[model samples]
Target: MARPIWSGTLSFGLLNIPVSLMSGERRTDISFRMLDARDNTPIRYERVNADSGEEVAWKDIVKAFEYDKGSYVVLEPEDIRSAAPESHDAIEVEAFVQASQIDPRYFEKPYVLVPAKKAEKGYVLLREALSATGRIGIARVVIRTREHLCAVMPHGDALLLLMMRYPQELVDIDEYRIPEGKGADYRITAREQAFSEQLIETMSGDWDPTQYQDEFRERLQQVIRRRMKDKGVVRREDEEPELHENAATNVVDFMSLLQQSIARKRRTPAQASATGSDAPQSDGPAKKAAKKVTAKPAPKASTKAAKAAAEKAAGAASKRASRSDSSPAKPARKAVTKKRGKVA
Candidate 1:
């Protein structure tokens, strides 16, 4: 069963409609894991004190305010909860404004606001009213103990609650040095202004999200797969020499190892290392070459080979993580920094 991320009531004026918040999006990016290069074991991260390098338990970690250099004020969870704004169990609307007035840059995440059984009629009424007026409810809502300034409006037949950042969150426009056309020694001529409008019209097209994709991610995965296959080819050629020397005895053990590798792969598809004997050789088609293998890879020998493959996989994974960390978030604006308010 799908779970509600938040359960609360939508409020505007005297009317209240019980609503449950459900996430509308699920991220599907390929996730990579960290591994020890030596034995191919996964590496686990620990939250530790920076200076001491000792892992700290959750209970021992306290929220602290760094009021000044080298000074701190610790506060318990209870202290924070008490200081937070009182929860009214409602999204209190401060005003109704033209939906277009809200800049797209201010919007963050979105959730589907589903109505409760008893609140369906009221929900529909509000949805229709908002649609008719073309105005969104500018409201404050508390979700997961955090207050958000949001806009609730009809999106098609559904009500979309778009979380919004405060005005202070936007980078001060004064910081930007916009191109000047007056005293700065440049001016947009009649021809330039007319041509700019013509260019905009030439490029304008309807929004089609399906046409766009994460090409970088797709290309990176392709490279990783290609590298794995190349490593597979190298492994086969390296084993060819040993196979020819002890052709009879080595062949028997090789078959046993090959069978084990196949069975292991069926059990754990992820464990199928790229440079294993089961991998295809470059000399011929994979199916034809597999049918007439002269030698099988030794089981014991494959262990070190697995680790070698792991080292390559781990390196690729590390590079991916580094790229992911540096990639800009899809959202346009940063989280609002609260006015340097006094600590409660």
Candidate 2:
């Protein structure tokens, strides 16, 4: 089971419903890390003192507000804690309004509200009432440290808490120079409008999101798989120093170590040092046995040989793409025929 992000009470008038907030979205984007291209070593980011260029420990760090140019007001942990909302564990509903009254733009992220143990009665009551009346409860909820304006509404069988943007955060539509009049004002003839409508009507279908896919991501994944199969991947070894639990208390000769580190030239890990031999490390006994039986360790290839192999893979990918492009697509999904409007 997925862990709940927050456990809180949902408050409205005199009623209180104990609930847990669960994330409603999944992140599927491929993440890339910055690396030193010269040696293919992963880059490290550190918190360093700007003036001294010395790394600062996390325990020594303090929050500060920059009130003016080159001026700051340091705030302690106690100071920040004091400023936090008094009832941080409650999603207090201020008012109930018609769902239509809220603009689509105001909705940001969504979180599903799950009823706590033995709290299903109140949860069901709110969801049913919201669904019947077509109303959403405007609530103020504190998730983590920041307070957010949210809407608690009936989403199928559950109550979904959708984070909302503040009024000031939204830009007025009057700021843009949008067309004020109908198609006639833009010199569009009735025949053009009719043709456009006809085109739209012919292409329209049910909104089945599963039918659509992130084409770019899929294509990128295919390319990556092809490259991994042909060129293989470098197995990176972690080299980060493990600090003791009480890092502050652990005494060490830091100045000497810093000087030594600065003087030394960083090199690639042993596994990746030999170019073109990037076979993945076997993690399981079955994989180890398979590696031993099927493939021998690749000998370091010449620069010319590596280039030729890369070119071959590129050519194969290009042919596959060409075949895909020539294949017929569903009429509704792709433009099968172009209908031109009559020139008036």
Candidate 3:
């Protein structure tokens, strides 16, 4: 087994278990190094004293807190450890809260909690209890030298210790401007609303995260590989790609797109019979035809109320048309001629 980054005791009221913490995630991002423009040499960094410009040894370094300008309180390693919270060897559970009550932004990083020797039963018991109650434990833990707010919860086979930020650490959402009042602004119609719903239904599928991969990263790697093969290599193109004059082509009117989507879904059986395949379906051609007629002409705040109004209006119009169709038409009245008095 791989060596654990941390070995500590996980504690609740009267329960305790020896646990090892290991990172839950690994970064796969491509890393880059800075190079000199002329010599193409990799840069080296060094720590130096700002006043004397002399290189400082790592062992000689001491951390300090500046309480005032030009004044600092230097701290030694032993002094710092002594001042830290007393429960350094334990994860002390303070409270348990509903999983839904936690704000997503507060959680920072996660680690897998593995059971140590003789602690297997306790670990499984805690994991099962957390899963059954649908609650997560809020706790304070000291991972290295720094203390952190953490959440202890159940994972598939092991427990997860998720680091969290204090409430004060998060910036208030009110600091930024955002669209308000349930989108009370967009002029959405009933037809559009119905179509959008159908479109959602047609496109809905179970999420499989494995189906997607990083396209940009893959393309970047391709460029890197091509350069490695030949330094002077240039990308070749088959033909000039067409440029669209209308920017609104992609941000299509929601309702029109939705209707097209539904129609496409409904036509699948007939299309399958003709093609003899389950694939090959599209709303692109239909959307292109109706783009000019149904595109959202103005870029403005769109709201939800449009659906209610448009549907009501459409329903009323339909009722009026139905009533007119069933009723008999009235005949036009003939003009009455008045007998004029005899004039000489």
Cα lDDT of model 2 by residue, 76-174, tens digit: 988887777888899999999999888899999999999999999999999999999999999998877778999999989999999999999999999
lDDT tens per residue, model 1, 1-344: 67988888888778888998888778878898999989989999999999999999998888899999989999888987776679747778889999788789898988899999978899999989998999998888876667889888899889998889999999987799986556326443455445445555655679999999999889778867877988743322233332332243423454443443445445433444554444433234654665556334455455565555555445545566555533332121121111112122
Best by lDDT: 3
Candidate 3, residues 271-338, lDDT tens digits: the string is 77996654323435655756655665432212233444445445555676555533221110100011
Instruction: Flag the better candidate by lDDT, 2 or 3.
Output: 3
lDDT, candidate 3, equals 0.77
Determine the backbone clash count of candidate 3.
4
Clashing pairs in 2: none
Whole-model lDDT values for every prediction:
0.71, 0.76, 0.77
lDDT, candidate 1, residue 256? 42
In angstroms, how far off is 224's CA in candidate 2? 1.3
> What's each prediction's TM-score?
0.62, 0.64, 0.68
Q: What is the lDDT of residue 38 in candidate 2?
A: 100
State residue 329's C-alpha deviation in candidate 1, in Å. 67
**Which parts of model 2 have CA positions greater than 4 angstroms off?**
232-344
lDDT of 2: 0.76
